[model samples]
Target: MTAVHVTPTEGVDQPTVLPASRRDVVLSYIALTKPRIIELLLLTTVPVMFLAAQDVPPLWLVVATVVGGTLSAGSANALNCVVDADIDQLMRRTSRRPLPRHQVSTNGALYFGLALGVVSTVWLWTLVNPLSAMLALAANVFYVIGYTMILKRRTTQNIVWGGAAGCFPALIGWTAVTNELAWAPVVLFMVVFFWTPPHFWALAMRYREDYAAASVPMLPSVASSDEVSRQIVIYSWVMVATSLLLWPYTGWFYPAMAITLGIIFLIEAYDLRSRARDTEDLSIIKPMRLFHFSNAYLALLFVAAAIDPFVK
Candidate 1:
C-alpha cells in the first residue's frame, strides 16, 4: 500500500512561517527609517546647540531635541522609502532598502511615516517649542516628499537646492537652545547647505553607474567627471572659507580646526580630480575616502565650534 503525504502550505490559503518572519518584519520597519542618516543628521544639531547656548544645552532640552529630531528624520526617511521605492529597486545601493526588498508594505510604511511625523511634531512642540517643531516638520516635508521624490528624479541640481532640507536641523537645534534665530546659527545653516553638494557629489561620483541606471540625475551622472570634480573642489573650498568666518563669531579654536580640516578636504578633492582625469572606470577610491572622511570632518569641525565657546 502507498501512503500520500499532504503539504501543510498547500492546505492554507495564507502561508505560515517560523518566528523569524515576524522578527524580520519588525527589523524591516526599523530599516525603512534609515537610522544611520538620522544619526548623522542629529549629530549636526548638537554642537550647534551647545555653541548657541554658550556652553552646553540643558540636559532635558538636549534629550528632547535629539529624540524629537530623530523621530522626524526617521519619519521622513520612511516616507522617502515609500516614494522612491521604484527608483530604489533599480540602484544596487538602494535595492536592499525596506520597500525595495518588499520587507515593508508601501501602505504600511506610509502610515507609519505619517504617524511618526505626528508624534515627533507633538513631542517637539511640547518639549522644545513651536518654532523648533516647525523647523523639524519643514525638514521632514522637504527631504522625503520634496527632495527624494520630486527634485531627485528631476534634475542634477537637486541636491544643491535640496540641500536646504538638511540645513534646518542646525536651525532647529539653535532655536531649541536660543528660541530665536541669529546670524551665528544662520552661518552654521549656510555652512551645511553649501557643504551638502560636494559631500554628496563625491559619493555620487563613486556611484555614478547606479544613479545612471536608476535615472536618478545625480550631479556626477549628469556632468562629466571633470566637471563634477571641479564642483567638488570649489564647494570644499567655499565650505572651508565659510568655516573660517565662524572664527569671528567664536574664537581661535574654530579657525585652527578649520585650517586643518580644510587642507585635508582640499587634498581629498585634488586626489579625486586627478583620479577622475586619469581613470576609465571612474576610480572611486579617492572619492570614497573623501566621502567617508568628510562625514567625520564636518561633525568634528562643528564640535570645535561648541568647544570654542569654552576654550580658554
Candidate 2:
C-alpha cells in the first residue's frame, strides 16, 4: 500500500502523495536547519568576536563558538519550521519545505530540533562560557516560543520585536571572548534589531501575496506599499544611527566605513520609498534591490568593524 498525506496547496488544503527518497531525506533534515540563515547569523557572530578581542582571538575559541552557535541557531530554525509547517504549506514561498513536502516527519523534526538545542547549550558551556551558553539558550527559547508561537500570527510587528532573537549573536560573541557583556556588543545588538524590520519588510513586500494567502499579517501583506516603504525608511535611519554608535568603541576606520556604507543604504532605502510613492506595482517598485543591498550593507559593515581593531 502507498502512503497518503494532506498538505496545504497555495492556500487550499489538499492531499499530496510523495515518497521520501534517501537523498531527499538527508537534504530535508538539513533544510530544517535553514543553512542560509545560519550563515547570516554567523556573519554577525564571528565579526563581533574579532571586535571583542581587539586583536586576534584564540583559534580554538572561535571554532568552538561557531560550532556551538551553529547548533543553537539550527535548533531555533528547525523548531520554527515545525511550528510554521501549516502556514508554510499555505504560502508558495515556503511550500517546498520539508514539512510541506512530507520529506521529514514532524515528530522527527521536533526531536531533532530539541536535541540540537540541548547539545548547543552544553557545547557552549563547556567550551565557551556559561554566559554565552545561557544567551544562546535564551535566544533559542525566545525565537521558538515568543516569536514563532506568539507574535508571528498575532501582530504585524512580529519581526520587529521578534528579531531580537537574532541580536543575541553579538552578545554571545562578545561574552565568548571576554566572558562578559559590554556597551559595544549592546550597540551592535541595537544595530541588528533596528536593521531587521527594513530588511525583512523589503522581502515581505516582494512576497506580499504569499503572506496574505497564509493569513499571516506581515506589514507588507496588510499595509499599503507607501506605508511599508515609509516604515522601511524610518527603520533604516535608526539602524544607521545605531551602527554609528559603535564608532566610539571602534576607531576612525570603522566610523569612516560605517558612514560611507550607511549613506549607500539610506540612498537605496529612500529610492524604494520614492518609487513606492509613485506606483504600487512591484515590478516598478523593485524592492528586492534594497533587500539585496541591505544584506551587503550589514555584511560589509560588520567586516569593517572586525578589521578596524587591527588597522587602528
Candidate 3:
C-alpha cells in the first residue's frame, strides 16, 4: 500500500506522511472501511432480500441498499481504525493501516467516518425505509461501541458477541424488500452470528502473535490451542445447525447446498482441531485453511439462498 505525504494542518502539531500517489490516497481511505469485510456483509444482504421478496427485488432498491449499507459499514470500520489506531500500530497485521501509516490523518479519518455515518443514515431513511436505516445505524453503533470500544480488548469472547453486529446485514436486506422482519432472515442472522467465532478465530489463530502483541483478547490470542480449537468446533457445529433451520423456508436446492457446505465447513473445522491435537508446532497447524474455506462457504451458501428462490 502506498502512502501520501501530508503537511501539518492547523490543529495537528506534528503530522506524519508517507510517499504515495493520488490513487493511493483514495485506496487508503477505501481500505479504512475494510472493503473485503463489507463484501461479505453485502453478500448476506442481497440474498436475504431475495429470500424476503420471494423473487428478484427491485434493482433500484438493491442499488440503494447496497450504497447505503456500504456507507454504513464503511463508517463503522473507519471509526474502528480510529479507535484501534494505538494498538493497530503495534500489530504487524494492522500496522500498515491509513491511520498507523499516516496515509490518512487521525482527524481526517474521524471526520470521514462521521460523515459517512450521517449520510448513510439519511440515505437509507429516505430511499430505503426507516427500519432498514435504523437497523444499519444500530449495526454501526454495536460494531463501533460494543465490539471495538468495549468488548474487544476486554474479553476473550469478544468476537463471540461482537459478531452480532455483522448479522444485521441479513435483517437489513430482508427489511429493505419487505419493509418487515421475518423468520428466514432471522435464521440467516443466527447462522452468521454462530459463524463469526469460528471464522474469526481461524484468522486470529494465524495471527496470534500480532494479536498478542497488540494486547487484544481475541480467543486464539489468549487461549491454548486446544481451547481455541474446542471453541471453534463448538461454534462450527452451532453455525451448521442454524443453517439447517433454513430448510423449511428454502427449497430443496438450498437445503442440499446447505447440507453439503455445512459438511465441508465441519470437515475444515475438524481438520483444524485434528491438526492442533496432533501437533504442538503452530506452523503445522494451518488455521487459514479453515479461514479461507469459511469465506467460500458463506459466499456459496448465501448465493445458493438467492438462487434457490428462483429454482424452487
Tens-place lDDT digits, model 3, residues 1-312: 122233322322233467379898899899999998999999999988888888889999999999999999999999999988877777767777788778888788988899999999999999999999999999999999999899998999899999999999999999999899989899999999999999999999988977887778888888888889989999999999999999988889999999999999999899899889856567888998999999999989999999998894
lDDT of each: 0.82, 0.91, 0.89
lDDT of 2 by residue, 257-297 (tens): 99999999999999999999967899999999999998999
The lowest-lDDT stretch of 10 consecutive residues in candidate 3 is 1-10
- Candidate 2 Cα misplacement greater than 4 A, ranges: 1-21
Best by lDDT: 2
Q: Candidate 1 clashing pairs?
A: none
Model 1 lDDT per residue over 62-130, tens place: 999999999999898888887777766666677667765556677888898999999999999999999
Q: Estimate each model's TM-score.
A: 0.91, 0.95, 0.93
Evaluate residue 281 in candidate 1 and report its C-alpha lDDT on the 0 to 100 scale.
Answer: 64
Clashes of each: 0, 0, 0
Q: What lDDT score goes with residue 59 in model 1? A: 94
Backbone clashes counted, model 2: 0
| Candidate structures ordered by TM-score, highest first | 2, 3, 1
Q: Pick the candidate with the highest TM-score.
A: 2
